[model samples]
Target: MTPGARVAAAIEVLDDIEARRRPAADALKDWGLSHRFAGSKDRSAIGTLVFDALRRRASSAFIMGVETPRAIMLGAMRQVRGMSVDEIAALCTGQAHAPSTLTEAESERLASADLAGAPVHVAGDFPEWLEPSFIAVFGEAAVAEASALAARAPLDLRVNTLKGTRDKALASLAHLQPQPTPLSPLGLRLPLTSDGRGPALAAEPAYVKGLVEIQDEASQLAALLAAAKPGEQALDLCAGAGGKTLALAALMQNKGQIYATDSDGRRLMPIYARLERAGARNVQVRPQRRGGEGLSDLEGRCDLVLVDAPCTGTGAWRRNPDAKWRVRPGALDQRIADQDQALVEAARFVKPRGRILYVTCSVLREENEDRLAAFLAAHPEFKSLPARDMAEQAELPGLVAFASRFGEGLRLTPLTSETDGFFIAMLVRS
Candidate 1:
């Protein structure tokens, strides 16, 4: 399809999403199913435009002074794609499948598009309700932080040390020109195309052969911060799909026993195949069974417990921009409840002097610092560790500069770390 046709389709998809309040993926999939004539590339291009529109929806609407899907597409062309008015006009010639030619108002708006005096929420392209939480966490830098989160995220792959080194993986994917991530020793990053598409990793030998795994750089840093020692006993309390569990196995040189389990058995199903493909050893799966005693045998014997807790996922907005719009205050409350429960469960397995590495892909204080503070208050036997000391022990001393001012932990945001938003803290059982 032509780029103009793709833009038209993306506008329709966005309209469906807004009207039905459905997920963008669901709307996009349904659109693809109904319009079978669109090839894979056409569908991908349309999806990219739809996502980019969503990413800058607030600012786009503000600039165009309209919230309609057509205005969104035109404004996004100016703001996201950085197209000149003439450049955009070429695509909207009102011929064939192209979007109708922009009206005089739209052309003028595109030419004079500026967010000079817009509200922080509009300027940041995030929900207005989230502004207070962002301000609470970021102070005067809230707009900058949220704007960063509203941008596109690059693809990041973590080299599976159990199967290959970072250099080996880099060489294997050389055609993609992947670069080693600045923060993560094991991460290789591939920039997306201008239209926001990543390489098809399923066809890549490096990915298929288990030399690399798709993971955000911040997540890789979380696993590295755990710093699991060889021959230690560890438990991955919420090890959904075993991303970090496999990393722990490699870090332990496949010498330590790592028990991976999640509250939902369905989430744990993928880990088995991933473990086999990655050639991971010394890791056991404990899928929660219906009404069954769960991980009872793991009580009070773990040297390390990793809680990759659930949250609102605000930190991952760069990859899932629609999520930031759909999220509500109730979701944050529920996520905080879940995070608190996960910490309580993690504490049950840590032996004396053992540590619990609490991690979450959330920038909200209610999910990170507040939850940890409550956990520390309730569990007197556990104490928060200084971020500096933890970083030094993990051999990632550079992270101390990003230590949390709200409490004990390392805070990584797109603005601060150029990675996904992640909060990682360690609590030691005294």
Candidate 2:
């Protein structure tokens, strides 16, 4: 398909998403199923355009003075793709399968529209309601931080130490030009393609042989901060799909026991195959039914209990831009409630003097520091451990400076840490 046709397809998909208030992936998939003539490259290009449009939706609307699908696409071409007015006009020629020519007002706006004086939320490409939260976390840099969150994310992988070393995995996946991650000792990163899509690492022989697992750098670091050692007993209380559970197993060198369970048992289904692929023998899967005592046997016995608590996912906007727009206040409230419950339940597993790693993929203060404050208040026996001290003890002293900013925990952001937004606090039972 020509570039013009791809742009038209993206606009249509965006329109469908807005009209039905559905996910962009579902809209794109339905479009692909109906239009079988579109090849793989065409679909990929359209999907990129759709996501890019969503990422810059607020800014595009602010510039174009309208929020229609066409306006958003046109604004994206100018703002994101760096296309000029003439370049954009060439694509929207009113030809077959092409968008209509831009109106006079749109052309004038494209030529002169500037974001220099736009509101923070508009320039940052995030929801207006979230402005205060961003400000509370970043202060004067909130807009810049939000803009960074709107940028594209690189593909990151964690080498499975249980099966192979990072150097070995890097050599095996050399064809993809993987680079060592800045902070994670076991991480490798692959740059996204020009079209903003990541390589199919899952299909690579190295990944098939359990050498690497696709995980964000922040997540890898969160597991690292847990400092799970060899022969230690660890528990992943909310181990959905067991990403961190597998990382903990690799950290333990397959020598210790790692019990993985989730409140929603269905989320644990994929962990079985993943653990097998990664050769993680130390992990024991304990799928839980609602209100069931799945880990009753191990209560008050674990050396570490990792609660990768649920959150608003504000930090992952770089990959799932549509979610930034769809997230509602009520959803955040529900996530906070869920995090509180997960922390309380996870605390039950930590032995005396043991640690509980409280984690969330959110940059919001309410979900990170505020939640930790509330947890410490309720559980007087547990005291907050300084994140820097924990990082130093874990042999990751480089994280000390970054972790120091949050006082009691470490907060990683795309702007600050070149990683996904993650907040980790280590709590020790007295």
Indicate which candidate wins on lDDT.
1
- Steric collisions counted per model: 0, 0
| Candidate 2 error regions (>4 Å) | 404-406
**Tens-digit lDDT track for model 1 on 1-430?**
7888888899999999999999999999999999999999999889889988999999999999999999988888888889999999999987779999989999999998689999988998988888888889999898899999988899999999988799899889999999999988999999888788899999999898889999999999999999899999999988999999988988998997999999888899999999998889899998877643668888899999999998899999999999988999898888888898888888878999999999999998989999989998898999999999889998989999999999999999999999999999999998
Output the lDDT of residue 267, model 1: 94
- On the 0 to 100 scale, the lDDT of residue 270 in model 2 is 96
Quote model 1's TM-score. Answer: 0.98
Would you list the C-alpha lDDT of every candidate in the order shown?
A: 0.91, 0.91
Candidates' TM-scores? 0.98, 0.98
Question: What are the per-model C-alpha RMSD values against the true structure?
Answer: 1.2, 1.2
Model 2 is weakest, by summed lDDT over 10 consecutive residues, at: 398-407
Q: What's model 1's lDDT at 311?
A: 89
